[model samples]
Target: MQISRLPRFIRYASALALAVLALFAAMRPAAAAPAHKTEGELSYSSHSGLTNSADGSTGTASTGFQVLLPDGTTRDVNTFGEAIAIAGEHRGSTITLFEPVTLSYTVTVPDGTTINLNSQGGVTYAAISGSSEPPLRVESGSTVAIVNTGATQVARVQNPNGVFAIENKGTLLLGSFVQVLVASGGTAVYGNAPQPAPGAFIVDAPGSSRVSAVQVVQPENQTAAYSGSEGETVVDLLAYVATADSGVTVPVFQLRDKPAEDPTTPSGAPDNEWVLATGPGGATVSDADELVTGDYTFTLRPQGATGDYYGYTVTLTVSVTMPQTVDELRETYRQKLAHALAAYAEADYLADDWANIEAAYQQAFDAINAATEETAMQEAVAGFQTAANLVPTAAERLAAEQQRLLAELDQAYAAYDKADYTAEGWAEITAAYEQGRQGIASATSIADAQAAQQAAVSAMAAVAQKPADPGTKPDTIPATGDPAAIAALMGLGGSAMLAVGVVARKRG
Candidate 1:
């Protein structure tokens, strides 16, 4: 079929119509939703001038001195602030003060400073303040207060809680109190380092200082360190005895020792004799001996709960002295006592002899006693402590325990000799007593006193029944085993153990 072509103008007209329709369709998508229109400038008025600012961001504004609502505008402000706010924009615009404003200030008139008359607020003295804090203002309804007994400043208040209208810099005079707290970053207004108590201000925090709180400090006392060359000499020692479960007290000591001892005056015999000893409760060391012209070790220990304690270290020192045997010591003591006694006999010449007499008595004590660790009071206490087994056999703890026991044993023998025994016959009897005491005091937690008694009896029996010492015997019964000696050996062990047990229980 022959296609009849329409006129060019007609075709053009159709094409134009289609183009127009397409355009309308595309435009419809954008035009269908209405957009918000730009309104007129916002109106704002304030009597306080411009007091704040708003920073603009993303075509939106941040807060400023004064605010204009509709157009998102603002103005600067100074004082009696007043503003009319309106909301039109979707964004959150902020209004801020020009700077960190001074909340308030307090001026303290130090004592003796003559306070002059003032109108309002505190004294503004540029001489003292330099360029730091601003002058304080007394707001309306606020009264100027003085700490001391004088009128320091004045206040003019128009309305309650309103600012006190100040005129100019000439409003303040000299010698008036300066309100430090008025300016931002101002020096702290302090009457003094805050007093501890019964004062004007109290710090909220416990230990804070910095003019915010009170503090007490004293100068430390420092003593000159001891150098062996000059001061008085002394000797000290420490020993410990505790059960396996008990806490340990270590010695804190500058231990000293003698490499060699001076020989006796007549030649070969040992002189300046020494021995280790402990103090009451095993807390400190005392009476250390066995010296030459040299060094000796000393130590200290601390007390603890029944089972827990710490050892301490201490320096023990003794001055170099002439050699002396036990016999010599006894003789010296005798002479001293005799001299003192003779003086006492002379009524007019008698001086206080209590100390000298005691010394003499102790000297005589030496003659009557063999000086065994067994009878030592402290050693006895320690001996009973051996049962505790707090430390193993291999460690120094064992050696220390044995030492303590030996000291007791020595003391015991000494006592036995002085009591009913003799130095010559002091033998198995003493050993037996020590063993018995050891058994009674062992850490096993015996059921009752009967058990303890039985243990003591058994220990005594052990010594009594011991086989004869086949070799080397004593020269004197008094030195070995006299009747007094035997009886002492028999009873001391158990008695000591019982005493120890009592002490332990009391401590607990």
Candidate 2:
């Protein structure tokens, strides 16, 4: 009984020790590590016919235009000039600023229109005004400027909405949440908490350097934001209305509140969806796959004319449907390969050239046969098409080969006439020659001509090794018109070897 009690006491002591060690481990703090970040500088440029479509309906500087509506619908603007004159038909009509287009006249935004200023180009918002009811929202980028100075109640700042300003001689009434980059000589009137808030009023000495910024954010816990002298911030309040393309109109943009930027953190890629289109038409757009199945919008600006440098606009909405099914795609590829193969087979394939080509075709065909899925089969078909186009036209190949065979026949006859042979040997030689000549005359292809050429070479060989006449002396051979010529022909040279077949016989 005492021994059992001792064992229980030892177990309790071990458990208590383990609990003390766990508590000590929990008291230690973890080592902290600093986070790393990266940022990219904003770049700006402008170009013409930036985007166009296939089939030629819309093009850069081309006659027709298209307006993208809010509901993913498009309005065709018959001419570039017509598109610029009429305000858009829809209430939430929106237009994207693709390039800098100088306005011939002042443009006004009706009650509820928004403009999206893309980040890729420097745009000048010259002589522009928004209706007092629902003010225009502009999404700014690297280079964008608003120049307006005539009205009252003209600007109001809605935090997280947009920056606003009212006009004075050199004095301007700025909103509460404003991001400003005071350029050289640009001055601002601070609005204090007890009085008005700071950075609420800014004045641009009429002839001072214009201010520029990528973005500015409202400070935390402050009634009014500060007016810092640093002008490196990039602002983004993009807005535009073009009179060309039959009054292209866009909805008022919903500008976001300026946010604080940590110096240590890196910036990211621009939030703009604009893409540069190189060629005239055949514009394709998809977020991930080739067959897009939902509604999407693509904006295109025709490359500005080379000499005039005036850019054009085309905005369109497309609803992509699922293309072919796997089986359907397989069938299409099969048909295409079949057609190519048929065309190639009808062509004349030179024996030397066809050797490699035939091997390549067979490889592709084998791949197709081994394919277990649609993609693999499609790849095989592509390989086959590439090989098939290399074959030459049948007529051209046949003519070239026929001429070659004709030359060989002439050489064979010449060699035959010079050879010394008995009457029986001559008869055998003549029969084979006539057979080859007929084969050549009637041949319609390279293969047939090749066969004919081979037969002629055999006739020359038979004439060369004809047995001596039975009555003639064994050492006395028939007279060869030219012994030297006969010896040269027998020692086949150049293309002569092409005609001769290998046989184990000595020359007489």
**lDDT of candidate model 2 versus the reference:** 0.41
Query: How well is each residue in 391-479 modelled by candidate 2, as lDDT tens digits?
Result: 56667777877888888787767665424566777777777877887888789877888988897777657454554455854353334
Give per-residue CA lDDT, model 1, range 391-436, as digits (tens): 2233233344444544554455444432332343345555555664
Give candidate 2's TM-score.
Answer: 0.24
Estimated TM-score for each candidate: 0.15, 0.24
Q: Clash number for every model? A: 85, 56
Q: Name the lDDT value of residue 41 in candidate 1.
A: 34
Q: For each candidate in the order shown, give its overall lDDT on alpha carbons.
A: 0.32, 0.41
Best by lDDT: 2
Which numbered prediction scores highest in TM-score against the true structure? Answer: 2
